[model samples]
Target chain A: MAFASSRSRPDPAAAPDGPAYLPSSVRNMVKLVVAGGLGVGKTTLIRSVSETRSLHTEEVMTAPSSRVDSLAFTPRKTHTTVTMDFGRLTLGESGETVLYLFGTPGQARFRQAWLDTAYGARGALVLMDLRRPEVSYEAMDLVEESGMPYAVAVNDFPGSPVLDAATVRADLDLHPETPLLFCNALERESSIDALIGLVSHSLDVYRRNTGP
Target chain B: MSRRRDPVRITPAYLATGGRTSARRALPDVLTRLVRVDGRAAASLSPPQHHLLTAVDGGDLTLADAAGHLRLPVSAVRILAGDLLDLGLIQAVEPAELPDVELLENVLDGLRKLKKPA
Candidate 1:
């Protein structure tokens, strides 16, 4: 629910002279999902790392289009509009790659939007709040079911309980290979580290799948 | 006319797409970066189609971005963009395969640099 009101200055990378179009050298465009439960810091993390302000895009879908599990919760509504937040990061020395970070809306009724954002994504970074770990379960499950590799970051809020890492991992039922880290979503460096963890883990997963 | 029904200000998706739900060729996902190939807008093109082209005129914008600019659903943009693709008026630069090791490495390197203080 919090916006980046504290950071009033513009990003240096996105200065007035920056190129609006993708550099001709750019050949790759990757999509990464930033997901979590309601009130989690998906948007905050994206705001911290993205060169541009996070954008909200709306999708209108029929109620029946959602999976049965979601349908059961919203049977009365025939049509709905869901909005998702996204940010863009152009990386590498020559800007040969761009990463699109999509923050999924927090609600079971928006599963269709989640799937749309997850489609063709390389990996996902799932944020959790240790104070209410159970709220993140659905996001983690959706990420896993999409068959893409993912990393989990515990977004630290002030005064949040410091639970044992192993106990939290076991409660989440995370895989042995999944990368788990702690991050403060409001900090640009911390958010970037969480993204680094995800991309690194994704690289490992991709290598294992394709063989030496 | 039932008091004109609040004046139909927004263009319906069915009309914008000419009632076509799917394209003949496979459409790119919402995240796909699309660029305009032809700057000359066809006189026959609908307003929504024109808005889409203007959205991606010089810059590379994603299908979702175009939809947001056009005030239409992503589904409608997909169909409209497919029409443009079929006409060879635009190009889609599909993202590299997710499993491409080199691409992942490039992204990792970028994040590392970003982690450093600016």
Candidate 2:
């Protein structure tokens, strides 16, 4: 429920300067998804890494989508909305490649909307909550269904007990090839490391799929 | 005798932007960057549309970036951008395909430089 922009600031890379708006020698804007359950800090991670203040774009669900998308859970009398938090981080010294991080809502009802956000994304970073390991299933399932390789980051929430990593991994049913790491989403360094892990893992996945 | 309604007003409350609420929809793709093609054509656009052109005219920003820069909703901005596109006021630059190895290496290198010590 927290707005991710609280900690966000204007990234030096995204200043009013020429490099901020224009594409340089190599113009690459890659979409990346920060996937996780309700309180696992998807938005926090994006806010930590974004150069500019993160923008959470709310797309209000109209009557048609509610009628079709809101099954299982009864639709509210009012509009049902989906929020996709967007953040931009410039990668490489030249800043040729910009990562557009989309932090998606993790819920059973928003599956379709989540996929809509994930579309065209090169990969996803799945945030896992050790306290409620079951919620990780929803995130992993969505990413798997989309067929984009993903990495898992266990958010170090204040009260979460430090348990055996293997047991947590077993509960989540993670793939052997998947990369797993620990992170405190609120911390810039921790979040960046998690992201680095994801981008690195995704690169390997892509190489495997496409061959040498 | 029947009375005539105000032509500029569409709904009773939403008459702010001269009734051009923008039926405008459609954008090429999220990654498509746009640049102004005709400066003169921009003159005919509404204030919002002109605002969009000015931002896009600054550089080759994607539809999403343009919307972000203009602080307008993506859907609404897409619609207005689409209208300008149909008139050839702007050109959409489709992104080139990037190899995975090169892309990943670039990102990893960038992250290494940016991330502070644990």
Candidate 3:
């Protein structure tokens, strides 16, 4: 169980003879995953922040999946996520690179993939469509079960009821510390700002729990 | 430093699987002894090392699992894993692929039942 420490990386002060490792000024990359129910605008939000030329991830859709997959809630939707969606974005002047704007498949059948994607993520943005509020509990449960901190992003859908944050939190029975924000996923700046806020808040909470 | 020269035992399963073939083949006829430093020194590991050790001790976690558990970048996890390997505290094991769909579905169903509203 013994692991090499991150601090063991050649430190300029500790190892003068050590080769220059990471650039002094370069910011370390931080990964944040964007997750939600299907068609909850995960793609739209990533497209907003991603620089041109996002990476393409293609997975195969197998036929036998029909037997193992849960189609209860999902209508007969074609085009199984033969590919996963991911994007990269830079945050703040620190130039911290954040990879994995991962678009999770919404269907419960894809729960395995979703769990795999959740691996290694610092935190997640769980998107909820106000129109289909009940649909989000499943995603919320996954996030909670993984023991990763997550922020709820209520996407403003047309004709959707405007539920207050308190009401939403009550319905979801989330911990008070979990941040919840309203977002128009179609808007680039707003979505980014929401994510930024989530990251900051999550870091603060994590630090408090684990200490600096 | 307390040095002990324990015979390095390679398991037949490892040899049969042809895992780490190069390292196995190139291993010296006599394995170098491991020197144990003071427990106090070992207790105070760097952040990355601490995270790696925590992940490894938790179970047969993968590099990605360690990174995720520590909330560290993958590159950082990889770098730390290399160090642990050198120290002979951990060894890389091929990850088991996803279970069959039926198995996964059954597991999920079990999880769902467990989560049912009490």
> Using Cα atoms with residue i matched to residue i, what is each candidate's TM-score against the true structure?
0.85, 0.79, 0.51
- Identify the runs in model 1 with alpha carbons over 4 angstroms from their true place: A1-21, A63-71, A106-108, B1-15, B18-24, B39-41, B97-99
The per-prediction i-RMS, to one decimal, reads: 3.7, 4.1, 18.3
The residue-by-residue lDDT of candidate 3 on A61-161, one tens digit each, is 33333323634434575324433555544333343222336666544566655665566565788888878877767777777777776899888888878
lDDT of 2 by residue, A1-212 (tens): 12333334454454542223655554777788998777788888888778766665454444443335544465554446566777788776676888788888657677866765676777898998888867767777888888997888999988897977787677777778888899989887788888888888888888888896
Rank by DockQ, highest first: 1, 2, 3
The CAPRI-style docking tier of model 2 reads: acceptable
Please state the CAPRI-style docking class of candidate 1.
acceptable
Better of 1 and 2 by DockQ: 1
Q: After superposition, how far is residue B35 of candidate 1 from its true place, in Å?
A: 2.0
Worst 10 residues of 1 chain A by lDDT: A1-10
Candidate 2 residue A134 Cα shift, in angstroms, is 3.4
**How do all the candidates rank in terms of lDDT, highest first?**
1, 2, 3
DockQ of each: 0.43, 0.30, 0.03
Native contact share for candidate 2 = 0.42
TM-score of 3: 0.51
